[model samples]
Target: MKFLLVFTLVSFIISFLSDRNKTFAGTKKGLKMFLGLLPTILNVLILVSVFLYLVPKETLIKILGHNSGWLGITIAAILGSISLIPMFITYPLAAILLKSGVSYRVLSVFITTLLMVGIITLPLETKYFGIRASILRNILSFIGALIIGLVIGIFL
Candidate 1:
């Protein structure tokens, strides 16, 4: 993480030196985008925190543990599809789930579907890509996520 921060800083400095106006404009735009997404990010984080607090670890293990099998995978996929978490939060949350005894297969499917399919963003996607295309993409992604999870289960 430190290396990434240093690398990004160096890249930004170089870009600024090469084209000050454009670099500043780009930075401003990026900041604006981040701010725009901040509220949604915070809401997801708060909900996740509350959920983790309210739900016991034993319950989570029962649902997502190694023995959970197909049931766990289905639950994870459904949750991932409906969630609107940021990528940054998803990874850390995955780590927490793993530590709480979630199976790798389940985590794989959860992460894949969370990243690939976005039911919460369906309206926006439909507006941009048309309802048919958006739904088709989501369906394909869901299938792909299942395949990926199965492969991971077999290998890991």
Candidate 2:
């Protein structure tokens, strides 16, 4: 929030000192983009809330908690792939899970997949990037994430 505030203030100052007309036009464009994304944002929020509500904490812990081992990592990857979580929320949730006894290995896999693999966004990706490229990218990301998690687990 502080960064955003600082950025906005700087932008405003730059605009005020330079071309007010262009600034207004840019701001209008930005607002329109935000408004267009509002529905998707709301849908994500609802999906996240319902997901958390439907999946019991105990079950989550049991499957992804310590002693779950490699199977836990696999499960975490799968869950992360399917869920469309925003990155801003993903890190804190991972931290909370870690505090709640989830192993680092599992969290590593979860975070990797959360950032890299996007099964839910595949259609949009394919639409823009073509189906072949999208599939290849996703497949590579999934494999790369697993490798990264395994490497991190080994090191830490």
Candidate 3:
């Protein structure tokens, strides 16, 4: 907020001092764009906080572990992928899980698959790329996320 205040002050001064009207107009446009996006940015942060509060840290950690074998991993990934919860929510949730003994690898899979394979966004994706393309991309990405998680698990 302080940084934004400083930026606003700087912009105001620049706009006021500038002789060229074009420069002032350009600055105003930039400021308007920033202001327009601020609400979405703040909303995302608030949702993250809320999700972190609502979900139990232990359960998140359990989901992070793949001790349940491939079936468990598949189930967890499928659920996570189906979840339309925003990334802002997922990251802090992952942080809590990580702090509570969850494996980073599983969390990575959850997050990667969560973002990459979106059942909720399927309508939009399908509209853009037909049903087959969307399904193929999602399947390929899901498998890729699984493999990456396993490889990271071995090292971590």
**lDDT leader:** 1
Error of 2 at 78 (Å): 0.4
Q: Point out the higher-scoring one by lDDT: 2 or 3.
A: 2
Using TM-score as the yardstick, the better of models 1 and 2 is 1
Error of 1 at 43 (Å): 1.8
Instruction: Give per-residue CA lDDT, model 3, range 1-67, as digits (tens).
Output: 6998999788777767775687678878888986886677678768766865786766654544546
Output the TM-score of candidate 2.
Answer: 0.62
Write one digit per residue (lDDT tens) for candidate 1, span 33-132.
8898777767876877788789888888888888888899998899888897778568767886788778898999888888888998999999999999
Residue 50 lDDT (model 2) = 80
Task: Report RMSD (Å) for each prediction in the order shown.
Answer: 3.4, 5.1, 6.4
Model 3 — TM-score against the truth? 0.58
lDDT (0-100) at residue 32 of candidate 2? 95
Give me the overall lDDT of model 1.
0.87
Better of 1 and 2 by lDDT: 1
Between 2 and 3, whose TM-score is larger?
A: 2
- The clash numbers for all candidates, in the given order, read 0, 0, 0
Report lDDT (CA) for all predictions: 0.87, 0.82, 0.74
Ranking, TM-score, top scorer first: 1, 2, 3
